[model samples]
Target: MRPPVRLALAAAAASALQIPLQPPNGANVQPVLVESDALADRVGAGNLQKRAEALYEIAELSVDEYGHPTRVIGSRGHLGTINYIKSTLDGLGGYYNLSDQIFSAVSGSVYQAKLVIGDVVPSFTTMGLTPATENKEPVHGDLVLVGDLGCKSSDYPDTAMGSILLIRRGECSFGQKSELAGQAGAVAAVVVNSEQDEIHGTLGAPSPNHVATFGLSGATGGGFIEKLESGEVLDAIAYMDADVDIIETMNIVAQTTHGDPDNCVMLGGHSDSVTEGPGINDDGSGSLSVLEVAVQLSHYKVNNCVRFGWWSGEEEGLLGSNYYVASLSEEENAKLRLFMDYDMMASPNFAYQVYDATDAANPVGSEKLRDLYTAWYEDHGLNYSLIPFDGRSDYDGFIRHGIPAGGIATGAEGVKTEAEEDMFGGRAGEWYDPCYHQLCDDLHNVNLTAWEVNTKASTFALSPFALSTTRSTANAGWV
Candidate 1:
């Protein structure tokens, strides 16, 4: 059960923010049984496009200090995103119960730093909550390579003392790597990306025991590793002038009031974007897609409850979703039968990718959700591929606590292969969404065709789960 005080305060906040709550629409219409095809057919491109444009306009109206529109958590743009979702649902006529889950997320206050290796200054991202350099002076030292991933103490060499450590990112938090480096007597740490893309990470919290750390792209780091392996000596300079601040944010959760509460089908996407851009395709695409589904779903009565969550602070390491799961009671946790996360649903160079729930980390019965999603694309004669069901999105919280979870994504920051090009008909070697985290991820960044297909896929995947008692057998009958 939601706390009465919290709900009251949330309502008060909405009122103070002047968010318009509309009367329920078509309250007298009789709800029909939820059939997969029928629900999926209701997902239209026109409405989806309108929502996309609305989100883009919201971002445009909420500019940051740089005059760039952003929906980062606690910003006017994100607040508008929240209001837009709330008002859309409120117009549905009391078919759903709405609540706000509030929390605080701590992030780096600023970034005024650089990392120079040899004579080259590769593009880099500053790690969150890491310490600033002393007096803003760049520390120059010999770059000592840490063995393996540097997750364990044995990986640090004795030569690391008084030197800058080059650590590969994997199997550990940035904080842990920095802590181990500090213990090894290293002055600073440089973590290389594990993938082809750039690495932007957080230390989870302020770590006073940690030395200053930085992140580098995979290509740049790989070059450094190759040189070091060939017995090349390298000099490095690292500096970070930064601090931390806590931002107040909240998650918007709405559930169908008429369905069985004990068995719920939950769907979510983060509402906040990176501070760099509007993030329409990165997440506004997913967020608005879910919003349109919620609006359409209001006309139906389900056997199982359907909950929708618009999470905040996901760009800061899924803090909003993490806080929500942690705040749930055992009984409340059990009420959630399954969770589906939709992120980056409309990448310009899009490919239909379903979450591979067969990974050992997920709970039992998750594969059924994957099967349901893939079957939808297959039935429609569409091409789809399996992506790792890693804890990179809001679903991370649900999966960690043994909840069965799955979802779809277009793609982000990942290079598309030639085979994927043959499968989805886009140019190979380019990023699935080149705009990704940049300011260019605006309305035009979305591929409308891909967005429509995935939105329909979401409708198909979610309908049966809302009507069945168990996750396993729900989609089997429908597909």
Candidate 2:
């Protein structure tokens, strides 16, 4: 789902600016010495807040006529955001080596979606990347229930041919269910949520084998199931008009010009957003934090190479980071001392959550990375919690490659528990970011306290590593 962004500037401009028009190899760098605390002191809360507000303004200007302030990958908004970051780095006067890693991916959005069950028009959200209805018109068919969760091919009935398949959500991804429904000859697939509300999802990627897939609310879908159980045969109409295209985008990677390339410290945040809103809080917080740190670090020097990445296609499925990691050779991978990720650093109702790398999925030096954040928070008199090191963000790509990885998150759609409320002073029983992935995730979506604290914490944690990985006890053969 994560793809590339369009390069706003021409190759001539890049050449004129002395920017690396190609992907970076952390070459021609010089290392300087810097203290962790001194660098941390430069990451002012006011500075971060200022940049965040500017980001929101940029997002607003990028809004389409449809009223969506979307910085979704390959969109004009996203390209503008990338240009902003690149320009910021360029203004830093070549203190870092900058490069754009370009790649192609299918970006999609639903322009229109409609579902009518018999005489009733029910609410629905179209799954991204699902094929449009034939001619983008409503396809009328009998709604046939595909028994079970519709994970297996056998779960679909032969009667589903040319009909819309009503499948329950569970046991598999929406894409898997849609693919199976297509193979069974269903014209469209409606995946009903097992949970309460209507859901928004993706087919994961562009698929020729997918029909128009839509998600219906649990109440609406359950009502249909009950009517069917009562011997009612339903005729349904499904329509979807979507825009799906394979577009080229770029990942911005910058490393300190003077550092030990053989042993480097890296950090990253996704630069793209979902189709719904500007994603100011969801990631603008994180991306700007990295940018701020990278900018501030230009004032100092580092012993070990320090690289910052503003990844694209993360919202799609960590595509940018995955591609970047896969592009690395084994020796290059080994040269990476560790990677720290900053994702939603400023959720409205935030929790100071660090990546818990105790799980087997964690690489050799992950625990050390986790401890660094933990210690940093404690030292700052802030409460902290541990989130699983799952492949939910860009860190997954590096962790899977046996590189030590850790990061912080300010919670997403997940609800804030009473314990978290007690620790972070946010309301319990509410999502950490209520506006997450919505059109309202704009300038007001951030908790300034969470934004400031997390940004400072990130600076504290990364500064030491930038100096040298040997400062930590968990070195464990990391070269």
Q: How many angstroms is residue 19 displaced in model 1 relative to the true structure, after the best TM-score fit? A: 9.0
lDDT of 1 by residue, 1-479 (tens): 11111222334334434333233353533368677777777788888787877777777654533278777665567777887888888778777789987787764433468888999998987776677776667888899999999999999999999898999999888989999999999888999998877877777666666888888888889899889989999999988876556666789999988778988889999998886689999799999889878877766678888999999888878888888888889999878878889999999999999999873557766788899899999999999999998888999999888678899999998889999999999889998998987789998899999999999999998988888875445431112
Full-model lDDT, candidate 1? 0.81
Candidate 2 lDDT over residue span 441-467, tens digit each: 888888888887887888888877776
Q: After superposition, how far is residue 341 of candidate 2 from its true place, in Å?
A: 1.5
lDDT of 2 at 61: 46
- Taking all chains together, each candidate's TM-score versus the true structure is 0.87, 0.88
| lDDT values for all models | 0.81, 0.81
In model 2, where is the ten-residue run with the lowest total lDDT? Answer: 18-27
